[model samples]
Target chain A: MELSLCNISYSVPGKRILQNINESFKPGRFYGIIGPNGVGKSTLLKLLSGIEKPEQGEARLDGRDISAIPRKELARDVAVLQQGGLAPVGFTVKEIVRMGRFPYQSWLGGESVDPEPLINEALESMGLTGLQHRRLHQLSGGERQRVALAKLMVQQPRILLLDEPTTYLDIGYQLQLLDNVRAWQKSEGLLVIAVLHDLNLAAMYADELIALHEGKVLARGVPDAVLQPDLIETMYETRATIIRHPELDVPQVMLAPGVIKSNGLLSRSLEAHVRRL
Target chain B: MLLLAVSITASLSMGSAGLSFADVWGILLHQLPWMPDADTIWSRGEVAIVMQVRLSRVLLAVLVGACLALAGTGFQGVLRNPLADPYTLGVASGSSVGAAFLILFGFQLAIGVWTIPIVAFLTGIATLLGVIALSRSNGVMQIQTLILSGVILQSFLGAFVSLMVSMSEGVVNQILFWIMGSLAMRGWEHVTMLLPFLLIGLVILIAYSGTMNLFVLGERQAAHLGVRVERTKLIVLVASTLLTAAAVSVSGVIGFVGLVVPHMIRLIVGPDYRYITPLSAIAGGIFLLWADTLARTALSPKELPLGVVTALVGAPFFAYLLHRRMKDQRGEE
Candidate 1:
């Protein structure tokens, strides 16, 4: 399956959030969308998920306009994992994940295929088997995210749209989540698009990076091609240095401190340039 | 189910008129078509009092209880708030105004037998429509707007009821009784009035229980999960409003049953509406049957308002739940 946004534009009353944005995603790849806050990365994801329609142009699934698809039919092919996740209001992990089969459920709660085996497999794969019976609120942030992912796994969507899935997690949990997502994407041959705040992690996990700025696509390419220091600085309005990772050979970004200096010393230091070795 | 059976038996046997369990059962059994009328033991007056009056009231109480609880479950799910109930849309206040208008002004009935409840039902529907209209902005009915409109309409309609009552002396207590809510003198007429609406509304709500569960996750998530969010919201709102209006028309705006019954059921069986809606109906029937029994029998002849009995039991339980939630938050922090 192929998902693509065609000249998509979205706006709220006085503000334009996305502007004539066009991007296409292919299956069996992880695409990271990176930008500073409030740049319509989430809006773009919403459009792709068919949660929100674009004011102009269209989001298409395999050349068919997404809006033309019924919500239930569309849900069978696409799943979205939202940021900050959902507040677990006493729904057990199993119960929450079981809801993934809702699109397949009838008004009488009958499903075409049994959901139990799929739910169990998802629980096992996400390492949520132990916590399956526990209420969502009782679990830690990372554990909750895993349960949410397990829900998406049970949904069996070919396209996964993740909006900052690792927002509140610590470093360990962050890698763990991204690793699981990446592994699942490969195994399932799924198209995974994630809006990531951390450029380094985005560069590391995503097969290709699409950097968004001011509601427009700034650059779209392989992480090594897109993660240049100049583009990062220009997009973020901050000075940053990029270097190759010692082991993985991917570009990693490190921001220069005091880039937003109020003092004269830091301003003067910006004038000094070091010669290339 | 057993509790409901026990409650109905208790309700039948123990009212203001003292009757033994055997006599109550015999009266009921004798009323069945298969039983011979010649074999009936009770007097004409006793039969009329037991079968027609008390039995009908019990059935009405059960229907109203179930209706309110079903409405409560729908409202809470649609609003995604635990505090939301059947009366949250100010339908009670609107019905009160309708009944008060009939009583204070001595309005002549053109509808023959179905005067007060019909007026109240129509007014309740009108009030709900007004609230819905007031809340819609750009065709979207925001939750905050709906709740605010309900509050505003309640205050507005309540003032009218008060003004109407103040103008008439003889009907002031009568109007006050309506406002406080009662199941007194309710019969097969009231039961028939609520039956169709309850059956239809319960079917719609129960059928949409899966969608309601998704709705509890919030609108956007629900939409993403294959629910037609706006359509589902409108359907649930209409169905719940019908359930509430039907109950209020017959029972005169009984409070706390709608608010407390669903919460009690949710505590026992998780928050799944599929289980909650039907279970709430049965549980609510049991609850109100007992509450009404206490209302009429607790002081022998002097009957308490059904609303007062529910509020007395429900208010403290609501406070305890709120306090426990706060303590739980503190513990989590």
Candidate 2:
């Protein structure tokens, strides 16, 4: 499956959140979209996932415009996990996961037996087998993210859109979530696109990276090429060092705290550097 | 199911015109050979009072209870609020105003006994439609705003009803009886009046059970899952209100059943509407059947108001549930 965004722009009232932007995602790859706050990373993901229509552009799944497909049909092709998926009171982990099968089930036919097998498989893969019956509110943030992932897994969509799925998790759970996603993408040849705040995590897990700034694509390519220290420092307005992982040879970013100075000296230099970049 | 059957049978047998189970069944079977089966042994008056009078009233109680509960379930689901009931949208108050108006002015205009209920039903539907239209913005209906509007409308219409009642002289008892609600004089005409709306409402509500489940996740989430959120809500609101109107048309205003039954069912059997809708129908029927039976027997021949019975039972239970839920939240925190 391939997801391509063409000249996508989004504006609210007088302010443009996203400018004309273009990006494409392909199967069997983990793509990370990263940016600072208020950069429209979430908006771009929403556009790609068909949650929000682009104001002046279009997103295509294969050759078909996503807007042209019915929502139910589109849901079967793409699964989106929004940040902190709210668990309505009383929803069990398994029931939450089962909602992914909404596009497949009929009103009276009940849930598909096939989806049950798939849900069980997803739960087992995420190590949620013992917690299937647990209420979502009872789970820790990491476990909830896993449950969300399990939901997407049951969806079995060709394209997966995740928005800051690990924002609330500890480092270990973050790695565990990314690892599980990567494994599933490998085995199933799924297209995984995630919005991540942690550059190092993105560098570690993403096969490719797209950096969005002010709703436009700033840089996109292989993670190694996109995660350069100069790009990170320029985008984030901070000093950073980019290094290679000892074993995997992936880019690893190490940030240096801004040098504090009176009279706004440090911030001005950072601003000037960003402008120069 | 068995309990429902037992309650129905008991409701039929235990009225003022006393008939044993066998006698009730015999009357139902029409097994008596002679006309009125020896008038002295079994008075025609007793048989007439029991079979013709009480049976229809019992059926009306069951039907109205089912309608109110079904509408309540639908409203609660659509609003995503457990506190919502059939009358939360002001249908009951609006209908009361319409009925009161008819009693004060229209009855002397030579309309039939059925005219007021019909007018009340129409006014209820109109009021709901107005609320829906008012609350809509950017194709979305804000449930909280809708509820607030309903509360305001209810208060306004309630004032109108009170004003009409105060001004009217001869119709005071009639107006009071309607306001208090009853299953006393309801017959086949009332049954026929409510049956269609109830059936249609049930079908529409049941059809949207899956969407209701999605809705509980929130409107945006349901929309993402391919639910036509606004359209579904309109259908649910209109249908549920129509059910409330129909029930109110037949038997004045029966409160609390709608608010309490669905909530209780939710506690017993998770929040799934598929289970909740049908279970609420049966449970509500059983509830009102017993409540009406108590109304008939608790005070002997002089019956208590059906609405009073429901309030007496439901209000305490609702308060307890609210307290318990609050405590659970505190414990969790």
Candidate 3:
């Protein structure tokens, strides 16, 4: 399935978050949306998920406007992993994961197919089998994210929109999560779009990068093409050094001394340079 | 279920008339048309007390309790706030005001006993509409705004009820009993009024249990999970409001049964509304049956207000729950 945002514009009163943004995504690939905070990356995901409609233009699925699709029908093929994952409500791991079949279930809670196998596989994938009966709050942040990932797996949508799925994870959990997602994308031929704060992790896992800045598409291409030092500096307002990985052909971003300090200095000097011209 | 059954039996047999269990059962069995012709073992007065009075009162308690509890579950689930209930949303007050107006003006006979409950149902719906209308901004209702709207309408209507009551001359005592709530003289008609709404509301709540569980993750997550968030919200609101209004109309503004019963069920059931909804109904029946029984028997003929009994018991339990939650939150941090 193909998902594309066509001339999408969204704004709150007195502010424009996204303006005339255009992007498209394809199956069997991982697309990383990267930008500084408050740049509408999550908003883009919300539009694509059909949770929030754009003020102008549309998000289309398989060449059909997503808004025209009923929410349950749309959910059959599209799933969104929300930001910060689940809260500490009293639902157990298995119970929450079982809810992935909600769109397929009737109001009477009957599903046509046996979801047990799918649920079992998802639980095992996240290593949540033992903790299936444990309440969400009892789990650690990383565990909760994994539980969330387990839920997404059971949802088994062709298109996955992730909003900072790893916000609260440590480095080890982060790599573990991306590895599982990467493996699933390769094995299942699913389209995955993630809003990633960690550019290096995005370069490692994402097949392509869609760089967003100030609610506009700054660049979209392979990670190697998009993660250039100049683009990084322009997008983040900080001087960054991009170096090739010693073992693989992906670029890693290393910020200059004092990331915040360099951000101020570079932005100030860039302003001065523009003034001089 | 057993507890509920036992409570019902106990309530019927232990009314002020002091009928025995055997006599109560014999009276009930004798009333059934299917029973073979049998000699009357109980007196006319005893039969009247059992069949006409206590039987209907017990059934009304069960129905009203179930109604309030189911409505409470809906409110808590849709709002994603554990503190949310019929009273919290001002829906109970909305219906209360309608009954108060009807009684203050002696309009009770205009439509018979049906007048107060019918009017109450309409005003409850109207209050919900008002809350939903005012809560919305830019065609969306944020949780904070929805809750704030409920609070505002609740206090506003509460004062309005007070004003109307103060304005009345002779009916002040009557309105007070209704507002404070009682099942003292309620009959089979009151039972019939709440029964259909309870069944329909229970089904609606159960069907939406999945959506309500999703809502615990917050509205956006539920929407992302294929729920038509606004539609779900509106439907649950209307269905539950139907329950609260009908219940308040029939039984007056019974306090804390709605609030305390569902919360207690959630604690046992771990917040799954499928379990919470049905279980709260049965448990709520037991709760209010006993509370009403206490209201009847505790103070003898004086009959302490049913709402007062509930509040007396429920207030401390509510306080404990708040304290425990505060401690739990602090512990989590």
**Highest lDDT, which number?**
1
lDDT of 2 by residue, B151-226 (tens): 8888988999999999999888888788778888668889888888888988888988877988877876676666
Error of model 1, residue A64, in angstroms: 1.9
A180-209: candidate 3 lDDT, tens digit per residue: 888878988999999999999999889999
- Write the residue-wise lDDT of candidate 2 on A160-194 in tens digits: 78889777778898889888878888888999999
Q: Largest DockQ belongs to which candidate?
A: 3
Give lDDT for model 2.
0.83
Interface RMSD of each: 0.9, 1.8, 0.9
How many angstroms is residue B132 displaced in model 2 relative to the true structure, after the best TM-score fit? Answer: 1.9
| Residue range with the least summed lDDT across 10 consecutive positions in model 2 chain B | B31-40
Q: Which of the CAPRI classes, incorrect, acceptable, medium or high, describes model 2? A: acceptable
List ranges where model 3 is wrong by over 4 Å. A258-277, B37-39, B317-333
User: What value does the interface RMSD of model 3 take?
Assistant: 0.9
Candidate lDDT (C-alpha), each: 0.87, 0.83, 0.86
Q: Which residues of candidate 1, in runs, are more than 4 Å off? A: A259-277, B108-110, B317-333
Model 3 lDDT, residue B308, Cα = 92
What tens digits encode model 1's per-residue C-alpha lDDT throughout A1-277? Answer: 9999999999999788899988889999999999889889998988898877899999999999998899999989999988887786688999999998988888788988888999999999998888888888788988988988888888889999999988999999999989999889989899999999999999899999999987889999999999988898767767788888999979999877753457656654463222111
CA-based DockQ, model 3 = 0.77
